[model samples]
Target: MTDKQISDIKNRIAVIAAWIVACLFFFPIFWMVLTSFKTELQAISVPPKLFFKPTLENFALIQERTDYTKFAWNSIVTSVGGTGLALIIAIPAAYAMAFNSGRWTKDILMWMLSTKMLPAVGVLMPIYLLSQKFGLLDTKGVLVIIYALINLPIIMLILFNYFREIPKEILEASRMDGTSTFNEITQIVMPLAWGGIASTALLSIVLCWNEAFWSINLTASDAGTLPALVASFSSPEGLFWAKLSAVSTLACAPIVVFGWLCQKQLVQGLTFGAVK
Candidate 1:
């Protein structure tokens, strides 16, 4: 075959492969949303009926059973607050590590990253005890603090990588102009690295929003987040697939929508230094 024709065929195959992967990833989500509209019987029907009458009863039942707004508010507070706190801490830490490295800098970074390898359950007992001892259990502040700590390492790594890509001459020039440390970050590094920061913040926020482990174990009705609400649908008898699906959909909707809205920023931020 001619070179041009061969390239065209390869492109077609790549496109087809991409579509298949996308569909595979999206199918579970589509099924969850579809099942949310089904009745309990329909949700678990033999052959998994693709065609059935849809109803809002499951959603209505969820609303009637508990205060969704409260859970949603808690999720919003924790996710945004946690992400904000993590960024505030990560930015400076990453900046120093990137520009002002010492002999133990790489070791410190490795140690921070290693913390993530430890299963969260391993530390749950200690964390739970600390929370209880401090009278911070079931409080938004506790979740925010935990979320920030858990996400801190990744955030710092991401920001550190991005910061390293920046031209040091720009920062040095800022210093020559008598810029203070805070202004050097606020006026120069921040503006330049905004994309990476936004992408990191978005990722951290999503992680915080979807966190269920700590939320479930640490909080009760007072501070239960959306993931906790989804977990609440379970009982000893069995899972109510339909109602569970409905609540799951409600819980996922906000993050999904927010992600869609910020997709451009996410993409741009992730690819900030790819070309240059």
Candidate 2:
């Protein structure tokens, strides 16, 4: 074969391979969505019925059994509230660490990141006890605080990197212009780094939303979020496969859409420093 023809064939093969890999990764999600539209019998049918008449009965059943809206609202409040709090705290901390690194700054940052490595189970007892002692269990505020604390390390790390990428000269110029320290950050640093902030906020929200262990353990009925709601499906009888799928789909829909809509910003923020 001619060199040009051989190259074209190789490119086509690569494209096909990429598509196959993507399909494999996406299959479970597709299955969940598909099963959400099936009856329990259809969902568990041998060889898994791929082409069945779709139904909204499972969704309706879910709504009848649980207050889907309340769970969804709790999710929205905690995730967004936690993300906002994390950003408020992380921005200032990262700003200081990025621009004015003391000798121990790296060690502090490493220690913070190390917290994420520790299994959640190890600290669950203490956190649960603390929450109960404070009467914060099954409360939205506590979940928000917990989510913010859990995500703080990664959020600060990302903000730190973004802050470092901001030219120091800009802050200097702002100061020369008689801007106060607060003004320098609010007016210059924040605007320059808004993209990174938005991306970080989005990530924090996702992590908070998908946090099942904490949500399930810390909450019972009142403040339980979507993840907790999803876990509640398990009963002594058996897993209602179709209804479970429906609930899972409903819980996942908003975040999936949010991620899809913000994909460009996500890509940009994650790749923020790669070009330079």
Candidate 3:
């Protein structure tokens, strides 16, 4: 075979390999969704029944047992609220870091990134105590604030990278035109970098939406998110696989849909600085 034919064969092999990996990664989610429609006995059967008649009993039980709307609302409030707050803070910080340079700027950025490396459990006690002291436990406001703070570094870093890619000559010309800092960022920088900013915001929102740790640990009945609702399926009686799977499916539906809708932007943002 010619060299071109050999190259084509290699590309086909790579495509097949990628499809296998994708199926493996996606199998658990598919199983969970499928099991949600099975009876409890079928869900836990040793030899799983792949073609059993589907039932909606689990979903009905879940709806009757939990106030799903309340949990969903909490998730929406915390995730969106936190993302908005983080963007508000990160935009200016990234703008400044990108447009201006100082001796310690790189060090400061490294320090900020390092904070994400620390184990969250290590500081859980102090944060929990402080929340209680401030009467912020089981409050939507507290979740919003914590989520914003937790994701701030990542948001700033992403926006900073995108901002750095903007040509410095454009800012110089804007400065020469006597544009104020606000005007430059609002009119010039923002318009030019809108794609990056939008993708960053979407990613931050996704992260906040899927945040299980803080949502489960910090909030109780009044402020419990969908994750908390999923956890509530566990009881002293034992694990109800069917009901649990149904709750899990319901909890994941919104975020899955949101991610699917924004997947193009997500891909673009991830590949932003990868190419010239």
Candidate lDDT scores, in order, read 0.88, 0.88, 0.86
Q: Please, what are the lDDT tens digits per residue for candidate 3 over residues 94-130? A: 8999889688877887898788888889989999999
lDDT of 1 by residue, 1-276 (tens): 999999999999999999999999999999999999999999888999898989999889888888888899999999999999988998988889989989998899889988888898999999999999999999999999999999898888778878887899999998998999999888888898887888888878888999999999999999999988877777831368888888889999989998998886666444433333
Would you give me the overall lDDT of model 1?
A: 0.88
Alpha-carbon runs more than 4 Å astray in model 1: 1-21, 236-238, 260-276
TM-score of 3: 0.87
**lDDT tens digits, residue span 82-197, model 2:** 99988889888999998998999889988998998989999999999999999999999989998999999988878887898899998888778899878878988999988888
Evaluate model 3: give its lDDT.
Answer: 0.86
Residue pairs with backbone atoms closer than 3 Å in model 2 (clashes): none
- The better-scoring model by lDDT among 1 and 2 is 2
Which regions of candidate 3 fall more than 4 Å away from where they truly are?
Answer: 1-15, 235-238, 267-276
Give the clashing residue pairs of candidate 1, or none.
none
Worst 10 residues of 1 by lDDT: 267-276
Error of 1 at 120 (Å): 2.0
